[model samples]
Target: GYLGCQDTYYVGNFKGIGKVYSQVFIDSYTRVADAKLYTDKTALTAADMLNDRVLPWYETQGIPILRILTDRGSEYKGNIEHHAFELFLSIEGIEHTTTKAYSPQTNGMCERFNKTMKQEFFDTAMRKKIYTDLDDLQLDLDIWLEHFNNERPHSGKYCYGKTPMQTFKDSKKLAVEKNNEILYLDYISDSQNLTDNQVQNL
Candidate 1:
């Protein structure tokens, strides 16, 4: 099951780029993460993060994002009919849960990730080069994320010192088995209901 957390971070002002933001997503179990740079923070941008990166990756892996945890920020919380983020989640059949007020631990995975990115990526990158455009910053970020997910060994409670990708691949079989078990149980239940209806017709 894909339990995930999402948060937006202020990536600071760049020379010609002005202020940039980052929409970030992290898998709670495996700590695998993805981020995209945006010029502004909005409901549409929030939804785009999942549309452009998170969901597609999960689709390739043959798993579904079961639920997502987010903060009470305007970009994340609103009416399903009017808000882009809410509507996107509704259309995708993914559950959305919000963190409790003043409870930072509720979204700790994403919070910790933001810190890591600041220290390891943004801090270093800013010192090394001047970014003139969102696309340029995004390109370098993507390269760093590739290393973060595939090369760095995560000490997350569930990762056991393996890279996020390694942990995800190692545990994917169990996730598939559990999903199959759920489907088999549902099939049995439906068959029983159908048999009861046939007997009632007699």
Candidate 2:
């Protein structure tokens, strides 16, 4: 059972966009991730990200996304009904779930990835003092994310010694095995950073 998760982070103001945001989406099962630099944060923008980037990628892979978990902020809450984000999920036949209020752990996977990006990618840019413009930042991100999704080892996230894309393919193969239940049990504890409230609900 592969699940998806998303989170947003402030990437600092750039020449073209003040308060630029990094919108990230990742596979809870595979650890494969994607990110986009956005000018602002809103439900419509998040929905657009899914429509334009995430879903299409998954579609091309012929992978079915089971759900997308997000925090309960207004950008994702969408009236708990037919908000833009929820409507998008409905149309895609994907479940829409929110992290428990006051609980960051419920959304730990994406949060952990966000922390990693800040350290490995954003901090590297800052170390080189290269906050020139959005295009430059995006180019840096492109290189970083390519390495992250394709080559980096994933041990903490139930992947013994494999890259994210490798884990994704392995997990899909695991799903068809006779002892499929073990795969679920194996990847269960990747949420150590989640809030207590989130742990309970999740």
Per-residue alpha-carbon lDDT of candidate 2 for residues 1-202, written as tens digits (9 for 90 to 100): 4478988777777654577888889988778899988878888778888998898987776566767889987778766465888777888878888898899789888878988999998877877864757777888898999999889998865678789988877776554452345445545644443555587898
- Report the number of clashing residue pairs per model: 0, 2
Per-residue lDDT over 1-202 for candidate 1, one digit per residue giving the tens place of the 0 to 100 score: 4698999999898889998999999989899999999999999999999999999989888888889999988999998899999999999989999999878678989989999999999999999998897898899999999999999999999999999999999989988787677778989999999999999999
lDDT of 1 at 164: 96
Q: Residue 177 of candidate 1: its Cα lDDT?
A: 83
User: What local lDDT score does residue 112 receive in model 2, on the 0 to 100 scale?
Assistant: 86
Per-model TM values vs. the true structure:
0.92, 0.79
| Candidate 1 regions with alpha-carbon error over 4 angstroms | 187-202
Off by over 4 Å in 2: 80-82, 174-202
- For candidate 2, what is the TM-score? 0.79
Candidate 1 residue pairs in backbone clash:
none
